[model samples]
Target: MTSNDIRFDCQHRGDGGPLVIVPRIDGTPLTELVDGFEIAAGMQPAGDAYGGLIPEFFRFGPMQDHFLGRSTNTMGPKTPVLGCECGEWGCWPLMARITATADFVTWDAFEQPHRKARDYVAFGPFQFDRHQYDDALQALSAEIGSNVDDTRA
Candidate 1:
């Protein structure tokens, strides 16, 4: 689908701590989508083997930088778009090549680092409107930040 079909949001794991910010696309959790793709391909989904990145990575600056192709941490040309359910990025990752232009941000070349043989070529090359993409990121960051603040209060 084109950028218009893409959206970004967050899902909080209850009692999973204020720092936990699990990203959701449309209304489904990201891990579920990955699992669905795997299942559709006749391969078992990672299930609990997948999860969100650590809290630090969700912050506006780092996250924005990563998506915008300005971050240094990368696996070759692909970036770790999702991480292990254990909260560590390197353990298990869903990598993608993210590209941003003046008006659109595109994500393609998805790979499951540990399952090199599993093909994700048909999964996604989701293109997102730059404005919507940025707004979603900012909103997620703000929501996360506010949650953290509420927790401390």
Candidate 2:
């Protein structure tokens, strides 16, 4: 595929649960998502557990999205630090690029002078904008429709 061509795959649970999107891409491995429903502890019986949105991890690595798995509530403040309770790969400097590209995410910065090394600066956990997410999914769906037509031609 060319640089403009992007392909996506969707996987569904046999039990009729949330669907997962697999974006096959080659890059810096910047972001990954984890919906609130995926968490076993805080899962609600009804509605989208993550407010119909998927939270993204700014950093990249194996299972980085699951770094907050131990926490019952993954919606809390996210500290972009390496080897924290949340996850292993922590990159505070990526905030600029993340916000610039992701219009749906809003950054909330704070201070923590007590911590060692990465003191005095930390941003809140990234949250997904419901409207933007839905819109994005719709766009992807439309792309899939067009792809089907292209193949028939």
Candidate 3:
């Protein structure tokens, strides 16, 4: 796959729990890429924080709009692209500026919320075709949504 090509996969925790929606760019998991960058930079990678967001938080709605560059969270124009392994996004988050246009969507300016000194300037400015990116999001969201067991009374 090209550098711009992005794919979404569900990562089962093998504990009979919820599934996480992981993003793979050019066949490399995003968490690995970030951790590799940290290692190359002589910094300790935040292993516990290197994980994809829970499917519930990644469903198509405000989260999708955030990724599409249509909305922003408390981080201003940046949004949390990944969260902690414990499933608490606010505990540890990898934020990035997502820019979308009619033709393309780009993610850049990555920052670890708890590490202000860490420079992620060399990490990414990964761009993807808008059509493909949107399609991937919708498909993943649908899959997760369908499998959700909402037992609220």
lDDT of 1 by residue, 1-153 (tens): 555444445555557453554556666776788888887788765566688766564443456677666656665888777788877778888888889998988888998878899999998777778888888878766776777677679
Error of 3 at 110 (Å): 0.4
- In model 1, the Cα lDDT at residue 83 comes to 81
Collision count for each candidate, in order:
1, 1, 0
Candidate 2, residue 21: the lDDT equals: 34
Candidates sorted by lDDT, best first: 3, 1, 2
lDDT of 2 by residue, 110-152 (tens): 2222223332233233343535443444655565455445546
Best by lDDT: 3
Clashing pairs in 3: none
lDDT of each: 0.72, 0.29, 0.74
Estimate candidate 3's RMSD in Å.
3.1
- TM-score, candidate 2, is 0.23
Q: Which is superior by TM-score, 1 or 3?
A: 3
TM-score of each: 0.81, 0.23, 0.83
Which digits, one per residue and each the tens of the lDDT, describe model 3 over residues 50-120? 77877455443444675675643445778777777777767778888888888888999998878899999
Rank ordering of all candidates by TM-score, starting from the highest: 3, 1, 2
Superposing all C-alpha atoms, what RMSD in Å does each candidate have to the true structure? 2.8, 15.1, 3.1
Off by over 4 Å in 1: 4-7, 11-18, 57-61, 151-153
